[model samples]
Target: MNVTITTIYDELRGFLDDHQVSTNETILEQHSKDESYHTPSLPDIVVFPETPEQVSAIVKVADKYNTPIVPFGIGSSLEGHVIPYDKGISIDFSLMNKVLEVREKDFLVKVQPGVTRNQLNKELKKYGLFFTVDPGADATLGGMAATNASGTTSVKYGVMRDQVRNLEVVLPDGEIMHTGNLAQKSSSGYNLNSLIVGSEGTLGCITELTLRVYGIPEHIAAARAAFPTVDDAVEAVVSILQAGIPIARVELVDEHSITQVNRFSETDYKEKPTLFLEFHGNEQGLNHDIEFTKEIVEDHGCKEVHFEEDNAARNKLWEARHNLAYAYMHLNPGKKHMVTDVCVPITELAGAIKFARKRIEELGLLGGILGHVGDGNYHTSLMIDMDDPEEMKRAAQFNEEIVEYALERGGTCTGEHGVGIGKMKYQQREHGKAFSVMEKIKLALDPNEIMNPNKLVHSKRRSL
Candidate 1:
């Protein structure tokens, strides 16, 4: 152990219990990596801080020592956002998980950053409220906010940044600040809440969040529509939106993904490019929307369409879609998963997916194309044999091609995964001159570059 880290470890015990601080190999290894395919590096120490005060003290110590600080959540992030590449102090937030408040009438909830989406939902159910911004994974709200994640319902409810009302962040120098307040609208000076929510811990550590929630839908319906081709399915979605159908969720599952879903879920769904859709409204309005949706899909050559009216059936259908990544992992044993998260304008969605599918076939790689097409975001789920140099190279090439296509057509390199090293290379091209502004902001907020170094933005001071 290095002298500096060893001293910091000893000093941390003064503020936390002996068991709260850990140097054991198992704990270090757990905090080293997330769900990404990126290589993992162990942090020098892992600390469990129960309160924001302890978090501030830990950051103060790290700042004094010029040590890198990486916040660890549940490690469910897909873009390596939680990996401690600099090997310093890993602050695990599991010990601080708690739903601090629920203002049911105001439709706002205050929660510690460590609380998971499902965990919060369970609590919100008591008041007939639910948090939106689900990123498929039961990711910690902090990690979701860090990545600015969004998923199926994003077309209707918006992304993580939209749901976030306020954030209690601990800055790099251990000073705590609140980025926003509970008011519904604000013309306030700077929207720091938006800035910190998707910083990926580069700017600060999110200790608490005040988020907006919604009442449970009065009428919910899930429907699956099979199409002859990917283009047809996507066209249907665009048409639905244009027709003013307020879709709660509309996901596109290509034939490859459908096959995986069938095998993994033990269902007899047709192996065709399909659209999984949902609607929320009063019973009469929802019925009309469903009928209109069927007509629109039929106009675009939909082969068959069916709806799930009950909660159990709807949940099961969505569960299958959410588990699609796991299905690929399960089928491709001994392989690592890397998903491309490029989002484009609604008009460019079909061409982008077509381009990605062609590249996957040209590279002779096994991958599936699927996404929340309702919001013009999709992913190419790739499974790679990391040991094979040729396979790794091809996978890298595919990702680069997909990202390039997205960037060329006015799309983002990363829609929700955050920069997280995987999409770091495309930042300059995607943001152009604005990329410099991001770097300046990072430096201004974290001059020492101790907050999750080597992520989202480049650091001027930190070499590693």
Candidate 2:
């Protein structure tokens, strides 16, 4: 809008084609917000850069103009991670979508940041290989690494940070930096991989990545167990983990979520608290694991337990689980979703889930509880009418209460979703004296405040 910003836009058009650099209102609106319930704000410009060199060129321009940079993926993130509040430039990475290399022998793959999980998996399937980190939605690998995202498979494989071995990052001041080597373990320098993984774009923009992949298991199995109460299902999960059975994925879908899934997925799963479980092993080992898991869940009051060995049945079961969120949205037509992600230690998970349900019922909120329970992380997909002040207030209170509870129990306010604008208020509470250390790192990496400003670090309790 001003002369300085106007000059930067003119120069951007000069370097990139007219189509690559856009000031159109429709494109700006599309890049404005993520899938979160947070209010949307448009960026002044949206640029799609196809190469890391182009990213560097654009970053240099942003530095010259002192403009903000908010990297955009597929907008699948639920934490407002990509909102361009200051109306600077939004760098949409969709154009950089490509898998550069797939090393089947080393179990590694190099890809651009814009490549989605589904896209990468489809390519990897040829060599009997697959990327392990799956966050349900078809989010860009760059965004997933930025958020350190994890979903069902995290229990056995770990999160995005674990899968990432190398990162090609474009810094705030127009410099390119790589995080680490492809070695399985490293003890050399400052461990930049961990630092940048969950930074929520506060430090820099990710341009490329070398990720760890996995071979398809020799044999695979899936199961669904029904519990009479939420507490029972949670307890069963805790027991299974305690027994140290190597379960690949264990998800909790409550009765409310089940009913919603049935409505949208057109499947008749019993409307009860249930655990969708999966195992990865050889045929003999998988059978042994399934039997042991069965014994443990039954001990914790699991009434009905069923297993699926056929590939089609297993895929369908996971598909339904992934579509549960859409079901909730479909049921709540005009309402906005306020999703919560809190993870506690295994010992404290059952109590925490029970408390969350009690509070939700007491507040009379329309919501459902589901999550990757094996890792002690859970989410409450709350649907609320944003226009209703009373409902909004209750949702805020419920979120705060659960966060406080998780913190008191030595848990994190965010399990998978990064501290984009959504969890900024909880940073100091969760990290305490160490939160300032984070601020120092943020400043050291992004001193100009050009990369996704007002996000994870270098700020106190503030709204975006």
lDDT, candidate 2, 1-464, per-residue tens: 77877898998988898778988889999999999988899998899999998899999999888788899999988888898887789999999999999989999999999999999999999999988887889999999999999999999999998888999999888889999997889889999999999988888899999999999999999999999888789888887888888999999988888888888889988888999999988999888889999998898888899899999999999999987777788878999888999999877877888898889999999988897888889999999999999999999999999999999999999999888888989988899889989889887877778888898865432344
Top candidate on lDDT is 1
How many pairs of residues in model 1 come into backbone collision?
0
lDDT at position 14, candidate 1: 83
- Model 1 Cα lDDT, one tens digit per residue, 1-464: 87887899889988899889999999999998998898888999999999999999999999999999999889988778888877899999998899999999999999998999999999999999999887888899998999999988999999999999999999999999999999999998899988998899998899999999999989999999999998899889989999999999999998988999999999889999999999998999999999999999999999799999999999999999999999999999999998889999988999999899898999999989998898889998999999999999999999999889888889999888888888888889999999999999988888888998888877654443
What lDDT does candidate 2 reach at residue 21? 93
Candidate 1 residue runs with Cα over 4 Å from true position: 461-464
Worst 10 residues of 1 by lDDT: 455-464
